[model samples]
Target chain A: MTHPFGPATRLALVVLAAASLAACASTKPAGPVAPRGPAEPEAPYRPPSQPGPVTQEQAPGVTPGSVQDFVINAGELVYFDLDSYTLRADAKPVLDAQANWLRRWSAVRVRIEGNCDERGTREYNFALGARRSNAVKEYLVSRGIPASRIDTISYGKERPLDPGSNEEAWARNRNARTAITEGAR
Target chain B: MFRTKNLFSVLLAALATLLAAAPIAARADIVVNVDQGVTQPLPIAIPAFGGSSVGGQVSQVVTADLQRSGLFRPLDPNTFVQKRIDVNLQPQFDQWKQISAQALVTGQVTNDGDGRLRVDFRLWDVYAGEQLLGLQFTTTPENWRRLAHKIADAVYEKLTGEKGYFDTRVVFVAESGTKAKRIRRLAIMDQDGANPSYLTDGSYMVFTPRFSSNSQEITFMALRPTGASIYLLNIETGRQEALGHYPGMVFAPRFSPDGRKVAFSVEKAGNSDIYVMDLGSHATSRVTTDPAIDTSPSFSPDGSQMVFNSDRSGSPQIYVMNADGSGAHRISGGGGRYTAPVWSPDGKLIAFTKQEGGQFHIGVMNADGSGERILTSSYLDEGPTWAPNSRVIMFFRDSAGGGPRLWTVDVTGRVTAQAPYPLSASDPAWSPLLN
Candidate 1:
């Protein structure tokens, strides 16, 4: 291969160059053609910058994103006394913790969905569950979390924590749960 | 001679008095409360739809149509009287009377040799010894079964004094998955839970599906990749469109009886309230005004009044108001939390989920919220929807182990049975008669 290209390289290159120029001249407009440009070097790829966790004070809306996350991580189910929609005294520690979390993560969005056991009328139990969940939300709001970050819904007896029929199941069912969605910062 | 004269006199006097009382009783109709009754279903006798050689599958359909009502007990064919063919023309009062049946349905089907089927049926007040109603239907050969259902409907409407729900469909949430994240699909089945097919996959959580009276469209809540939105999915075309998707959550979607509007909850800035949107105009009217949480709105069959779940009572209770949001009254009394108030088809009762202590149950009461009765017990039983007949209620029952299953019960609290399902199912919505 080296012998074949070396000897005839100059003569073949001249003939090939003439043929290529003729082909280009045939395809192009008659008068003039711009000189062929030199190729430019390619640039290397760079990674994108990572986003930082939303800060409590920096997040939009009234409630902080960190506080809402803390409340969510701690747990969403808040309990009440038997047959009562009022938030029980025992539930305050959890509510206080949630308040602190909301304080830290003010931009986070949450839904306080009220739920109930398989004991009452489905329609009325919905209202009761709403009452319970709203009660929890009001407590959090009073403790300095903006009401806007805490949306309330009543699953009533639709969704339950425990699907059992026993007293423990009932106790677990008579409560509210929280869910987080993209609306949170 | 004296003793013979006395016997003849007694016999003649008894016959005369019985004949005289017959006309008065026949004029005075018996009032049967079709909606309210004992667990004992009404016993009706249909003697195989006797005819001369062309009954052709009509009797079986007629019998099934009445029996599936869960209100009528059709007598066994084997117990039918000899020569029931003659009974169709004119039921021998004594023969039906002997079986202790209250109502007798007899029909004759004949092919006129002109590519037409003629069905004539007579409903007899067996006790009264007279025909209550009779009609004749002529249709194509393929429409014999429909004709039979029509005849049965007439008989049912006459005897029960209420419209029949035999030609209806059921839409329910076919559920599968764990306790934390339940996957639910929308499924449609015949009123008897037959011919079940999925309308949508359980890709996301779906809730509170309701059928338009035409049975062609369904309104429900679904959480899509974008967010939770209320969607009206056309049952026939498999097309879906989002309805009123605001920045916040919108749920608890229910259609008005007329199917002209839908009432749902729209949450903005954490406050939830009931809003009704006219399907034609896309204009929304707020139906509730409290700072408290309100959702789950249901319209009465007449579309004049609405019942919804509200926490305005400090505890959750059911409240009823005029469709315009006037005359608001708390229908649910003290003792439990209530939710999901579905108006009965006949506009007599409201079925709802009740929670007391720690347990939840499906309960019902008069539309005024009196005579509240609980119909189910479980770790979680909710969402009681009336069967089209309004005689039975279907609801969801869940155990701690797995997904919620569907069950149905009579108003009397007896005859509770699990609704047949290939998968765990819940959130049943009954459809009105199709066509």
Candidate 2:
């Protein structure tokens, strides 16, 4: 937004006659397209102002089927093997149930949070977490759910379900979880 | 939230120790050996300065700086044969030699007529009884630490023939709170774990902060509930700008060698790809097109090629490609998962994080993916960032009982030291040597 109009376009003028200065010829040139920043989104750079620790317990506050109920009945959590974003066959039934539940509460929007174990690098885990969340969201969308209804966020290894460092804990941590962020239908 | 200004302030106390070192120089004419295996830290003595009380504190800073480099062992002050050696005194070679001190560093700090701190230091070879290096600096009292760092650099260079990294800064993420409610803020500190100050408030989760080659600007990933965005923060001005707004999650952001472009990863439709964006035009071009995850991009020193981590090989491994996304080839072989490949400053080697067994390691390999050597292994030792000299790497190590803390490792794997910080820290990005 700080860039001004007519920026990036430099025009040169040549006066061949004494009176030519009074009669100016102008031309509009093709200019590069400028990408609009998120200034319209009210402080786009800052996250939501609620600064605190993040955890799964934050999911129980939603209306229709308590967020915890959605986790229990619809199987809102999906687990992935090490270094693999591909869901196992066991994850399909959970996605099917999640899709059915989301269809019933069409007015409620959900967010899929992906996570990783603390094994790999943080940034790489971030991308892996992103892939995992989108994998879950893609499954939901493929099952007749609207893509717009599901938002995906990846916490990498920042938020772990269990504090243990063993295999059981890592397996449980490398998961994708779904929560209802918007009000329920 | 973990925003307590002193949520961990055990750091400043650690700075009280002197970090001086033994010289690599074996003889009067011998410079510090260039070989990593030839490390014989020179024994040096630095008595309290004669002039001001601050001079004594400054001597501690210099000693701490040198000792932290792992190249020198500062002798105990009680071991000084001479009780009070004056900076202006003639050569006390016999007194320093009596304590087996190979080098004697003496300095004096005086308040000039205008109140400036006029600091002078002399590095002497005890055996040769000749002054090895002598320098004086005049600065305001506020810059006393900088004066110490300058003296350390001079001593280190005189002995090792390599410029020291003490005069540099490290930008990292300082973490607080429990695992479920973690607060991560961008923090910067001296390379010797001094002068740590948070750059950003822990309002949002900040990740993957990397210094630009210019060292003035830092690009990192910030996550909010709405979405994740890549942002550029000016270190001096504290001005921040959204580098890019992608349709999906963008992470693992890095600046090009020239600071003119950035390479980052964006995940869309279950696929993650690396994209390079020119800073001037804000135009981005995708570097990887496969369905597999392709992220953690690092450009070669010459900027003609880029080495990045991709899962195109079934497991995440290192890959190399041209700057324009052509001729992509896999460079990593063997077992385990290889990710987080960072090209060295000299353009000849790449330092990376490898997870083969249950353990994670920091390793280095040639640009062609050959001569791979594992430097350090631990429960989790990832994110390898090379020093400007390519001789050292700083990474975060996390174990069962301990949280992640910054640590440095020599490429030879012989010298390992913790970048001591009182609080939990991670994702250390070393800046280019400052002016």
In every candidate, what fraction of the native interface contacts is reproduced? 0.18, 0.73
lDDT of 1 by residue, B271-299 (tens): 57889999998999998888776878889
lDDT, model 1, position B8: 12
Give the residue spans of candidate 1 off by over 4 A: A1-185, B1-31, B39-41, B50-61, B68-71, B83-88, B108-119, B127-129, B136-149, B224-226, B357-359, B371-381, B387-392, B399-405, B409-423
TM-score of chain B of 1: 0.80
Cα lDDT for residue B203, candidate 1: 69
* Each model's DockQ score: 0.08, 0.29
| CA displacement after TM-score superposition, residue B6 of candidate 1 (Å) | 71
When candidate 2 is compared with the true two-chain complex, its DockQ is: 0.29
lDDT of 2 at B67: 84
What are the lDDT scores of the predictions, listed in order? 0.71, 0.80
